[model samples]
Target: MADNEQDHEHTPLLQDQDNNDNEQHNHHDQTSHRNVVENIRNLIENEIPNGHHLNSSSTPKRVHALLPRLFTLINSLVDCSNVEDEVVTDEVVEYLCSLGQEVVYGLLRCIESMVAEGQRDVGRKRLLDRRAEITQVAAAAVTKAFVDKDRMGTYCHVLSRPYYAVGEERNTAENAIEIAIRVHATDFIADIEVQRCVQALWTGLILQVEEDESRIRFVEYGGLRRSRRGLLDWFDIGRLNVPKYQNNMKIALFIFFLAMYTFVVNNQSPNPNIIEWLMYVFVCGYIFEEFRLIFEGGTAFFLGSIWHWVNIISYSMFMVSFSFRFTASYILTDKSKIVQYNDIAYDLQALLAVFLWVKTLSLLDGNQYFGTMVMVLQKMLKDGIMFFWLLAWVFIGFLQSFFALQKAETKDFNAAFSLLVRGFLQDPDWELAEVLDNKYGFWVFALYLFLTSIILLNLLIALFNSSYTNITDSSEKEYLALFTFKVFSYLKSPDQFPYAAPFNLIEVFFVIPFTPILSKENYKSLNRVVMGILFWIPVLTIAYGEQKRYEELTGTNDDDDIQGGRRRYRHLTLDDISVEDLFMIEDVDENAAAVSGETAIQIANGEEGAVVDASFTGWKSNGPVNETFADFQRRRVKENEARAKAAAAAARAEEASSSSDEDERADAAAAAAAVASSTSAGPAMSEALVQTLLASIARMEERQKEMETLLKQLNVPTAED
Candidate 1:
């Protein structure tokens, strides 16, 4: 009976456990089935556009239409947190590949709409809202697909499509550029894939601009005539006003006019006239513009560019030349001083011409053939500064030594330094040595020659060679980066009027006043219409008068019939360039090796090596003190225990000292109180109390000494003791 009762009790508990397990299993199955149904519903909702419905029978027939929608849905679902997201993404990508051109076209259209919408107020707000909730994730996904190597054919086709209808009537190159600029301005600009796509598009555009024969045409009479559409249209005042390019053109024109002025001033007598006044106006305008750029950028920007300093120096010389010439011609009364000032002015003008030519090197910095050499030269110049710094100290040492030893023979410090420099050049004047007649002078001169002429010169040559070689190896990449920066700088420039001096004045007088009153689109149209009207004056004049002059000078119509003669003077562009032709650095590993080599060289030269922490590569932890996390933890624990023990011992000693001090003070106070009370009572009471207090005081002192001894034994000293 007992065995039966025990079995029955255990049976009920087992049954209860079985029932709980069944409930859990059923709940799990229901959740899994519900998840499947929800996934299918989401897939259908996302893949099919609104107001569209499809049954299983129609799904097969609509697969073509569904493919793009499916890709778009997959792209949107990229940020969704689910186990099937990656699998779905891969499926969508594969499906896109199978669909080919249709899918690519759909993606491009999607991107275009997105970018166009993003540029508008209401559309931007909508996109911002969607982005806040991580909706509409298709842009980055589409960009990724477009940049793939296998999809290069598709990318090229889309870019070469020639028509982008962003509410524009005519299809033009500007429309294409607008699309590219919009895409570039988006969040995907940082992606390497997006960068490549944009770069390729820019390259194609640049090539088109360069090879565009529409800018020049043969005239019926004979001489070449500039076409209605010319290269300047890309940077026209009424078009995308890129200030950097406009400034470059203005500077070039200023230089030309300045040269003409210099020639005229030198060739003719200084007389006030219309041409002279025009020259003055141009000069003043150029100077004002230069200063405006300088002040706006501030000192750091000015000092950072070597070209800016050159500009400053050239401008200063020109100003001086102008002042001297003006004073000599108009203000001065003395004929001799006038002649003297004129001569000074001529010399200053000549020096300014040289600096001007040097400044033109900056304009050629984008040329592929010449740009590398210019960059190498710049690098060499920078490295040469340090070499000169070391040489300066050596030269000073020689100067001091020679001055001290040859003071009697040399006239001054300048004379002695000149002599030392001459010696370094290996052509020392033995007469100076003979005049000095000092043995130490000869020794010092010999040492200086050995240090500077042999050692320092060789070291400088090696440094220059190394820097040149390194720069040359990476010159293509550097030049490409510089060229891209120049292009982007022009594109991003905020200046609305990108015209040269007199023309800029027209814009300031007419265009600027109307800007606030009109919408940007309306303003651009009006500005273009006005600028076109103004431009025709020059165009007609050039076609008639200049062509006639050219015909007369050539004496033959055949020679003047050539088109594109003016094309050679325009800016450099990457004509006929392939996607693969873009230059990029490919030697990242070599950079680390170069750094190691530099460090070794510094050590070899007995110079202090720069402190470089190896933690950048986790090498710092690989040294003699390499320890695991467990080992570190154990060490920290032991240190913490030692600190705790020290603190506890100090606390105990303090407590003992404090207790002993309190006891001594209490005993002394008790004795003093007893004596005071007895004195207040009477003479008989005072005599008895005094005897008792003295005994008690002696006992307290004895006890205090004993406590002090005990404290000493315990290594815990009290203040009184």
Candidate 2:
């Protein structure tokens, strides 16, 4: 019925297209939807070169020029803003899907050959040579197009509501996080080319913005309909914001909370003290947050993670222990009952202590390396679980065999289980010889040892090794992905208004009850006032640090000269050292001058984007002036952002036009919109950068002149003439 109804609904539109084609051409032409998509696919395939055909003339410079056009074509496929869900044409759907597939295929081809096709080292060693430059730049651009939405969350924007204005259409559509998971699931994480691309993307995407101003400044917040700020600007202090990055202050706050939790858990008694009671308040709030997370992330997501499983068991135990402790202290009348409840409570706490502290290691997510290590360990633990399941059945079978070998009353299950375990450990209890003197018992026991000890043990070992290798490469990508998950899942998890734990209890009890009765503005005002009072510490601390960072960033040119251009970069070099008698660091002018001079010559002579590979390790060029690599990467990121801005502008321009020809309209709009977006994206290009662009153009023009002269001298006809 639904299919017939849909066909009836769209029949007129289909008939109109059919009638137009019937009159216009007798057959569809290149201007048709299929042809347009095929053209775009061909262009995408050509950019990848060698994979589609043996074209060797493609260069990084050419890719850079064509990439912007490709993006504009893609963005113009479906007018996301005006396209209604029910009315979306299959032609537009095909175009969108085709673009995504062609882009992915191109990226795979580029990365796989990136290293093999490119190499040419000079006096100074380089990670990637000039030939591989196109591969790196193209791959980076593709990765950015896909993942830029991840950064859009930081803006918490007006333009990106309901869905991002750029790359989204429907509320029911799923975001492509499963791409990462599937890559991980299939053990494709170990592919070196893939990891290299991941590393480059990681180095650019995260290392640049991990300390961006996410939790500073008061601003309007929430959805289009339910948005709020405080009643007055002064009351609009940001106390509920969560940073996308794991900044120093956030790490410090987490450590402080954990420390307090640890102290209370170690020292608290059945009759809780004031401090212990405070900790209980915090625990209650934490469990509340977990429940909220379960609701927001969905039951499947919550249950899928092993950490959540641990959380469920631990929280259950804590609740049970609290019930027992309270019963023993106040409710229980009999002394014997009270003592028994007390013992049970202590035993449960003892077990919970093991769970909580061991889980703490997994929560040490401050460092990227730590996050990656935790991921590896978690994957291996999953592998170990499977082996244990098989081991359990094998052990049970052996125990049953021993039971049948002896008199029913005399069969000691514990003794047999222990003996089997010891034998597996290469120390068979020959003492069990008296119990199992029969040949059948002897042979079955030996067979059990061979199966469990030799075969199963080796299988488990091999599985663990495989799991390790699967996650061996791309640690930085894995780390950033983990943190991004935590941001979307827990820190920025669905809460109409967020309050950190302990303080959250007040919001739950007092604020939530009044929300239905209160007006939106008044509700927000209450939250603002309450948060301004409760979370003064985070607000004040982050506010001061943000202001100080701003001040430092706005330093004079003289400061830049003295510090070797440390603008926007936080890497510490010898110039950062302050001690007068510190001979350990090379802060003196002579060494600094030499390093800077070397880096300058390298940049002037070489033609490559910021490349991160094995050669980047102990890169001597990074030791001094970081202009050679890091600054190049920063410029690349800015360039990407500029493209996004340009696309958005072009989108508005295209919408304003009445032309039905999508491709023609996009080209015209992009030409008009590029000037505005480029100017607004960043500060004016430095004179040196302008000179470099001019020189590059001049060289290209000179080469073109040479080609024309050569062809004319050979009496060849020119296409232009």
Candidate 3:
């Protein structure tokens, strides 16, 4: 039993010694591991510092320190380990990767400090130098650590190209977006939304590229591709399109003119029935848009886009309506089975062609081919008389044909009968039809003769003469007298300002005088009769009024009063009148209404000096029987008239001079007086005059107070009254 107990105690002591040995080995192993960790930490800290100062010298030190850590990170991530055990290799890689991350973090903090200091110093020669240095070091380190250098270079190259996004101008954001788009770096980008931004930029860039190409092509070519081509090119080249509204208006105006010409000429066929005028009216709504800006002075631009579709539809409707009218009318009316007015249709088609030309105006620049074609007829037919004559002849032909057809129908004439009658009318001699056909020929030849001799030849001469005489006149006067009154009618008046010319006595009086006569509807000799009446009415009325007035006052029935009107008028001109005693009209005697002679001129001239003569007096002493009386009478009349005339003339001169203020003389006088006053005044003398004036003012005030008290008793307001 003792031996067993001793054995148990010895075993326990032996077990405790083994446990202590194991504890010591474990402690030694832990200490060695701690030493290894510290060595590794020291090595990492020596290579990568927490802070770095910004300088040329600091960069090399940073690069050298960062390289080892970068290599470690790469190798760790690559799992470059010689261990055959898969688990051990993974564990080693993870440990090394963690270490490398710490080193990388420390190095990055150092670089950040360096960059901050560099920015603060402004010690670099240029910003680019600072940026280049910082970027080069950072890029080199990042490249060694993680980024593939080849891919980054390609990315940078793409970023250099300017690309526009929302705005038309290419900018930095757009270039960055372009790089993202080209590289398909959507997944790599920090935010997914950036891809949409990149796409938008790409779309804008594509449009720009197309616009630039278009401009280059246009310059290479001789003609413009479109009217807005220049603008689009500018937009593509990153320039703003100016007066965009006006440009659009010009295009619309051209379109309007084309539409008008087509609508007027192309639809004139005597259709089976013309399209309802309502359809044309409705169609005019579209034509309205084309001209809306014209009435507004062609200043709107984008307004065209708002109604572009409407304009096109309206114009198309008009074209269709007219086309149907021409086709139906010609088919139904043709008796010969051949078109009667084929030439007319051809002319209509030619005019219709202008609409296409006008439409093309918007697409082209530089050359104005489309606009020219649309307006070509305006230049050719600008002569008003020529156009009027042509229109008149067309009207005459249409009227005669229509009347003839009606007459034939009344006589129960068929096509066969008409043909037979036509044959019978083809006689060689003494045939009325032959004479009418050969001589009249639709009245065209007669129209030509009348138009050339009367309208064109005479009016052209008159227009040139008037224009030459008034070229430098006031613009308002020229337009009012030459254009509105002479060529057209009273329609242009509403456009002029109320103060503008032709707001004159002549226009007011003469405009209404002959309107009723001119508007009379007489044929054959209408104009000749009208013009003759216009020329003579005023003259005859004035002469008759004078003659009757003279007869009434004198109670003399004398043929001499009526016969010698012109001779009396010349002798009693205004120049013969003396100025002092102005003559004016008085009440006319009712009994003298039938009297033969009176001249307003004699009254005016006689007012100067002459009085009624009781007995006959000679014209001069050399010719008459009562020589002494005539000489005395003439001397007295002449002396009184001379004095009166001088006084009246002086008054007239004063009135005329005062009518318009002369600014030059007034300004000169004012300037001279101002200089004199300034030079004459001085400080001390001015004060003395002021004091004397004040003393006199004080005395006047005292007297004024006494006068006011006295006036109060009389209830009068006055200075001293």
Candidate 4:
């Protein structure tokens, strides 16, 4: 009993010793890991961004080694064993963010260096050489990086290529921009250099998308052929695509042009003159562009936002109006019919004009006030959907009762709808009360007014007010998200070389039809020739302005000493922010409302050709997913816990089964021998039985002692209750 007490006392000491060894091992591992992280971080900071290492030359060996290594390090830091062990402390995550930041800085610096050659002469015009010249230098490096890295299609999305898993798949790719976005390196993204590159990159991608989308697959032209690269050379790329002249400037100009065209060529009177004919052709192409979005995004995606519905309704109105105007002038014979069509057409065109101008707000994302408000309004509109739903049900109930209770022989659904709408708009008709002489219909109307105008309307106001407050409180973060979306929107656009609307007319008629018939070289040259011919002046203007702006920003213009762009060495306070908060939209978890970085709560899915997510290797994702980082983490934690429990249970079951089988086999053998000895007969049997009994007894004693020893080893009490 005293020995048992001593053994029990010694057990805790042994456990402490084992635990101490494990702790030491863990400490050693942690120290080693920290050293590795520090070394990688140092290497990234020291080597990747250094001007000497960033070789635009043939032998950029250091860059080649370091860039790949830098990405590898980011991948490791994001997903290594520590992540699974739940030991991914805040420090490590922060350290990981720093490494990602450094990589972004390096890319930005590399671009700045490459483009720096263009601004050497202290002016926009002169550069080291033509290839090394101002506009060309910027285009070549920035464009090539985005264009060549085909897999880097949508870098701004959270669930972009290399799906960020908790333990296994969450790692960055060769695309530097993608890693920067994943790590939420906002300051890095916000930098002038990185912004320019990203802008140009998306521009290049847009150009590619347009080239592909524009192609006609006629069997005559061997069906659905696309050019290799839409913007063939530096000169051919859209001037508006570059920041020099500003794409927004180009978009605003195009809208203004569209508005003017519509007003001037008002075919409401069925007057198809030369200008009207040209306007008709131009609008046809514009309509095509808008309508094609339906096929690409599908019905659910179209219903995702208010803007999408507006696009569908406005364009549909225009098409119908055009159809009526054309039929009235050309197809219809009767004067009365013509007059009726003209009246409807006029009304529709007038409505379309309003929508067209209002849609300019969509492009106003460049300005902080307009852009942020646009986001808020879009959110509120979506929120109001539920309010509108309840209002509809109540209105319908009132309508049925009011119509049923009406003693009048004639009842108009349209009049009923108008009355309800007016009531909601604060112009309720008490005429029903007077006419009905306080009947059931009058009472129903009063109830409708109370429910809809008083109760439902106020509820909606509170909802929008709450939504407005939530959005505006984080206005800065929201704006940043919008800006990221601005960059991302460019990439999402299907048009590879997105010419502003009126200009897209040229591509639709001229470039697309000939693409499949023409050879790759010829097709490319044709696109180049067309873009240059149409936009050389603008392109040249952009180049000059960019170099001029470049000169001004760098202080290269102020003094002979050129104040070239500098590297970001230390992190600014703003740099250290939660990536999830700043960039990623909240997970919507539903397919319809999920898309883009609209906090938007634009958060889903499968594009047919593209098999995206972790398994995909393509540039575009298969489709949008409705998960965010937080959603993924919760799901992954649950899965890991389930798997762990399942594994542990299986192991214990196997261990117990093996132990029970061995014990049962040993006891069966003992029982068989005892039975055989007891059945022995006569003198010989008696002598053998005595011997067998003695042996069996001895064996039983040994077995009992062994069982006690085994129980002690297993921490099972030897004496049981």
Candidate 3 C-alpha lDDT tens digits along 1-721:
2443343332312233533434456776545433432322322232443311111211223334544554433323324223222322332332222222122233233333434564676753243233323322332233222212121121222221232223232221223322322222222222222222222222111111212322100001101111121221212111111122123334544565556555645555444223344334434543553444344222222132223433465466456646645565545555443354444444544654555554454334313343233223222334444555764564455336433544333433243234323332332122422233445433533453355556655775665445444333333322222211111111111111111121122223444355466553332134333323432343233334433433443344455546546523222643343211111111133113423334323322332112221111101111122223224345445433433433343343334333323343234333432332232223222222222222332334345567668889899866434
Better of 1 and 2 by TM-score: 2
Using all chains and alpha carbons, the TM-scores for the candidates as numbered come to: 0.44, 0.52, 0.18, 0.51
Candidate 4 lDDT score at position 350: 76
> CA RMSD for every model?
35.8, 20.3, 50.1, 25.3
Worst 10 residues of 3 by lDDT: 216-225
* Tens digit of per-residue lDDT, candidate 2, span 385-482: 99999999998888888867876677777777787888778887664844664546667778888898899999999998887776667566566556
* CA shift of 134, model 3, Å: 73
Candidate numbers, best TM-score first, in rank order? 2, 4, 1, 3
Clashing pairs in 1: none
Could you give candidate 4's per-residue lDDT for residues 576-687 as a string of tens digits? 5222211211111212243343322211121111112111111211111333334434544543443344334334333433443445534543444344334312222222
Compute the lDDT for candidate 4. 0.46
Per-residue accuracy of model 1 over 1-721 as CA lDDT, tens digit each? 2443333332312233533434456776545433433322322232343312122221222333533464455345433334232343543453343332233334444455554565675735554334322221333444355434222332333222233223433212222223333343233332344445445434321211211432211101101111123323222232223233344555567677767766655665544456655666666666665665555434543454556677788778878888988999899999999989888887887777677677777777756867667767767777788888998898887777667665564546776777777887888876675455357766677777888889988998998899778766766554554444444434322243344665555676778799899997798687666766765443343335433433343233454445576322221443333333322111122234554686434422321111111100000011012333334345435434433443343343333334546565445444443434333322322332333333333445456678878999999957864
Native-vs-model 3 lDDT?
A: 0.32
Residue 101 C-alpha lDDT in model 3: 19
Model 2 misplaced regions, further than 4 Å: 1-172, 178-239, 244-270, 425-427, 433-437, 560-721
